[model samples]
Target: MTEFQAKEMEEQEEQIENEAEDNKEAEDSAPAEEQTGQSEVNEETLRNKEEEIKKLQEEQDELKNRLLRVQADYENYKRRTNEEKIKERKFRAQSLVEEILPVLDNFKRALDVQIESEEAKSLKQGMDMVYRQLTDAMEKEGVKEIEAVGKPFDPHLHQAVMQVENDEYEPNTVVEVLQAGYSLNDRVVRPAMVKVNS
Candidate 1:
């Protein structure tokens, strides 16, 4: 071969090698950039998912707390209703007893009247028997008369209609019971009308 022709061939070969190396480097760097971009997208997606999970958990906890509060309120209402029912059952006979009190007082007044004849005496005996039966029934139903005469005056059991300056009784003492008081189950149905020593 001629010298000039050889030199031209060598230059062509060198240019071809340079082009190949540039293509190889561009291919390698393209994959690295693509990987970096993919990783950034993945990180963004993960952060979004975490935030969504946190919000959902918070909402679930709030709903659970509301459910617990409702259950507690329902339980309290049930307990209160049960207590009211028990109290109603305990005081069931209060109204009937109150209605019978006036009748009992009338019977007591009739028994206190003096009798002069045999027929009147017989009627008095009959009334006395009826009164005794009524009192026995009341006693069975937890009714009791409050002992106010000579007892220490208590506002809960006694209603003082008059105060007396009596030397025979101590201060704040119940000297006499004008009208009888009654109780049922240790609860005052009616307070005794009384005279108190001041």
Candidate 2:
């Protein structure tokens, strides 16, 4: 073959080989494109799943916080109810003590009667015994007499019905108690009517 003809034949063969290689590459790249598209879809789905999980976690946290607040409110309500019950019990006891005061006064009136006869003496002794028993019973129920005759005059526990100028006692001191006062649990049920020294 001549030199020019041989060069033209070699150029034609190289062109054919290049065309075959391009066809093979196109065949290989088709599946790669499909795989890349699938991968993108999977990544988007994974992101959506992550977002859903985060939202669920946030909702759970909110519910937990609400439960804690409800528990706190319930505990406060229970505490207030208990305090009210205690106050109600105290008031009830105070009412019963007030009702018994008149009976105590009647007992005192009976004990104050003076008699000299033998039968009357026995009766008086019996009355004194009954009075002592009643007083002991009241004391056991948290009832206590207010101190007025010797203690300083306090308006909270004593009512000054009369005043006296006395040298023996200090000013504003209670000289005599005209009527007794009673207390229950450090709360005064009745104020003592008393004479104060000026």
Candidate 3:
């Protein structure tokens, strides 16, 4: 071949090699750009998952609080109900005791009458025995007489129907018990009808 044709052929070969190199660089850059885009999508997905987890944790905490409140309310209700039951049991016999008080007073009046005849004395003895039995039964049921005479008058235990000036008792004191009063379990079932010293 002539020298001029050989030079032209070499130039064409160099141009072909440069074009091949450019194509290789473009292919390598395209994959790198795609990888960057994939990394951005992964970061967004991770942020969304973290937000969902936080919301779920908050909901769990709220549910736990509600459960604790319900448990506390149940405990309070049990305690209150037990207290009410105990109080009811303590006062269960109060109404029966009140009903028997008038009958007991009648018995006391009968025993107070003076009798001279032997037959009457025997009947009195029998009545006294019955009275004692009744009193003993009342004591067993937690019934007790309220002390009024010669004691400091208390509104809770005494009902003052009349006021009198008396030298034997201090002021605001109970001078006499007109009607007997009774108590059960340290609670007044019937307050003493009394005369108070002024």
Whole-model Cα lDDT of every candidate shown, in order: 0.85, 0.82, 0.86
The CA lDDT at 168 in model 1 is 93
Each prediction's TM-score versus the true structure: 0.70, 0.68, 0.70
Q: Lowest summed lDDT over 10 consecutive residues: which window, candidate 1?
A: 30-39
The top-ranked prediction according to lDDT is 3
Pairwise lDDT winner, candidates 1 and 3: 3
Clash number for each model: 0, 0, 0
After superposing all C-alphas onto the true structure, candidate 3 shows an RMSD in angstroms of: 29.0
Stretches off by above 4 angstroms in model 3 are: 1-48
Model 1 reaches what TM-score against the true structure? 0.70
Tens-place lDDT per residue, model 1, 1-198, is 458857975885686578569658856765675676664767766776587579667766965786697689679979999999988776677899899998988889879987799999998998899899998998888898899988999999999999999999999999998889999878999999999999
Summarize candidate 2's per-residue lDDT along 1-198 as a digit string, tens digits: 458757975885686578569658856865675676664767766776587679667766965786697689679979999999987776666777899888888888878887889999998898899888887887877788899887899999999999999999999999998888999877899999999999
What overall lDDT, based on C-alpha atoms, would model 3 receive against the true structure?
0.86
How are the candidates ranked when ordered by lDDT, highest leading? Answer: 3, 1, 2
Off by over 4 Å in 1: 1-41, 165-168
